[model samples]
Target: MSGAARAEHRVLIIDDHVLFAESLELALSLEGYDVRRLELPEEGGSMATIRSLALRRNPRTVLLDLDLGRFGDGMNLIAPLAKAGINVVVLTASEEIGRWGGCMRLGARRVLPKSGALQQALATVRRLHQGLPVMSPDELETLLDAWARERRNHDEVRQRLDRLTPRERQVLGSLIEGRTVRMISEDSVVSEATVRTQVKSILNKLEVSSQLAAVGLAHQVGWQQGV
Candidate 1:
């Protein structure tokens, strides 16, 4: 495509985190994207509003959040955009187990954690422009391991994940979906204490002080692929 076409790639940031979302919008615009920023939707903005944007602007890609202030999830918007033939890339801070797989299965074209630096996100967008999978060898390894461990015991999996786990891998997938610790405990059939310990361990292993930090780290890496 010509420079104009490439420049026409509309990028929408649908995040509830106003500051970060605005920063992303500014950054992406600086990087040569036709960018639009939508503050986290209240009760998830009307699907009609989104459809209108997609149909009118026909953005080349969308930067979505998995969780949007409990109003609606970025995942909820993926299918509609996909049906409209728009490309979607997740730009959330969710690190729950199985979330990566779930987003992909739900038809998101790609997932890039906002924790990842702007350069990395830009690289992925560049690849998207070129019609290629953006994952590098290392990112791919982390992603696959993350997807795999969701099915295994947390302790058993953490040992393996430590080597190169996806940054800030979230608690079990269900927990991040607004489920309670007791609920997750009930679902996973583990004690609430055990769940808390696992969450702590995951936080420690990832070297983050909070759950959001862990989630953000999933996308940020000091290393580059094929270096």
Candidate 2:
């Protein structure tokens, strides 16, 4: 048989719940899907690992959990995978209106809460295979609204960055590129102390905590385009 003929519909599930992953794997297996489960750690899973696994299975769809274990937030992985051309469906129990809306805008085909029935999730898979949009009508509307609002936010972030001095923007650019403070300082002809201060100010102005968060936010806002 050819690859698609011999292969069952492949599925890559990213979740920290071990028993749940096994259960899901077994369930999908019964449905003739080749399922691979990655149980994320308590501190969250690695994007590199998830991406590598996806490339390996090349699943037609992904079942992603918004909460990995304890501190693992799904926000970091959702947009990245979606941007990479993977079809992702967020499987989470979080019903927060904003989060649900945000996930859809970030390229999730569907967002199914764990509290819902397993049959619903399986139904979603069927819809995906049938080339039908997976999310519910309500969810679709929410996603569209969120996408529009997100565009506005991007414009706002751009305006904010435009107000920054050229040096500050340069520092932000280097930071987004994953350069260290020392490296940015050396490359930008600024002292390490000044680089540190600039980074601090940038974070404060952006209202983000870490460099990764800032980088992600910047990417979402189109500030770090072409990266």
Candidate 3:
């Protein structure tokens, strides 16, 4: 490609998989895009690196992945990259359709599953480069429906959580952290019997039949450490 062509079209890939990124870099380069791949760091400071690279390279598009080792989910980068006027296309192996809506809501250009055909993935990127919509009408509708159902489930979980007392909330947190009833009793300065009663109450309030189900509900509602 000519220097002017390279200057106009650049693609950056931020994925932790080195071999996959290198292969994608070669493929895109062969297709006349000035491609660069940054394998995400296993430790801290990836966001700063990404910002610096964006400023220096000024890539027109970024192919991103959600699982970035210890750096955490790459969804957090979507809004910032989009705000900088760079189109982001999520390339992930996650089969959850709700993630597609979440990425698009954060201004991603498209979400392409790694399970899809390589030629189709390349075509999607090329179309996005040309400012075309990647999703067909049926696909868009399916994603929206899945997103709506996810939102509804989230709301219900939050509502159920709100019904728990402060003490119950603390117990729920400990349970979600995989603590045994005896462990929770020791930490809370309560007897094992008291902790068992509290656990039963928690299960009833959370509308779950078992401790495992309650823990799953807690995760669905975005429970975190120290909650």
Candidate 4:
């Protein structure tokens, strides 16, 4: 390829998987793209490095890995990269479809599962370079809607959780751990009546009619104490 073609095909990969990154770099380079993968530090902060690079030599497209090891979060880098007028094509091994929605909402041009073949990835890059859309507008809109719904559900869960006192949170945690009300009361050295009152409060605060429902919600949303 000519120097001008390589210059126009500049691409950056911010992935920690050394072997994969090197393979992608070689593949892209072979296809005439001037690809470079960020050399991650031992501890992380890949977003900082990406921001620094964007200021110096921003590429036309970025093939980002969702998990960056200690190189900080790749998810957090999407908005800023897109805001910089760079097209972002997320490459992730995650099976979570909701996460792909988050990526699209965060301004990713495309979210591709890493399970795909290298030829598919190469084809995606070629399409982008030729000024083509990787996915349809309808597909993009659907993912964006999914993310919005997920965000709403998250905020609602958080708000309900925030209403709990520390004791209530502890009780909720115990419930999640499969402790019975009587057992919890015995462990805390409290009366059975007091434990029942706390259980009622927990149900009220969580807005769930049953203890099982509350526990299910906690696990589903990946609830953690102190949020």
lDDT of 3: 0.80
Considering only N, C-alpha and C atoms within 3 Å, which residue pairs clash in candidate 3?
Answer: none
Off by over 4 Å in 1: 1-3, 39-56, 136-227
- Model 4 C-alpha lDDT per residue in residues 108-206, reported as the tens digit of each score: 989888876467678888888878889998888888787788889888988888899998898889998999999999999999899889989989988
Better of 1 and 2 by lDDT: 2
Mind giving the per-residue lDDT tens digits that candidate 2 earns over 40-140? 54454466665666666677778888886554577667777787777788888876656677888777888887986377777877677667877568769
Number of clashes recorded per candidate = 2, 0, 0, 1
lDDT against the true structure, per candidate, is 0.65, 0.73, 0.80, 0.84
What are the runs in model 3 whose C-alpha is more than 4 Å off? 1-7, 39-43, 46-49
Ten-residue stretch with the least lDDT total in model 1: 218-227
- Candidate 1 has an lDDT of 0.65
Q: Which ten residues in a row have the lowest lDDT in candidate 2?
A: 1-10
Query: How do the residues 1-227 of candidate 1 rate in per-residue lDDT, one tens digit apiece?
Result: 46576677888776767887888788877777788876434554565565565557677787777776555556778888878777778876776636776676667766766686466677777788888976556655566577666645444434534543332233534333556668878877889898777777766775667756654444332222111
Give the clashing residue pairs of candidate 4, or none.
44-70
TM-score of 3: 0.87
- Model 1 vs. true fold: TM: 0.55
Candidate 2 ranges with C-alpha deviation above 4 Å:
1-7, 39-45, 136-138, 144-227
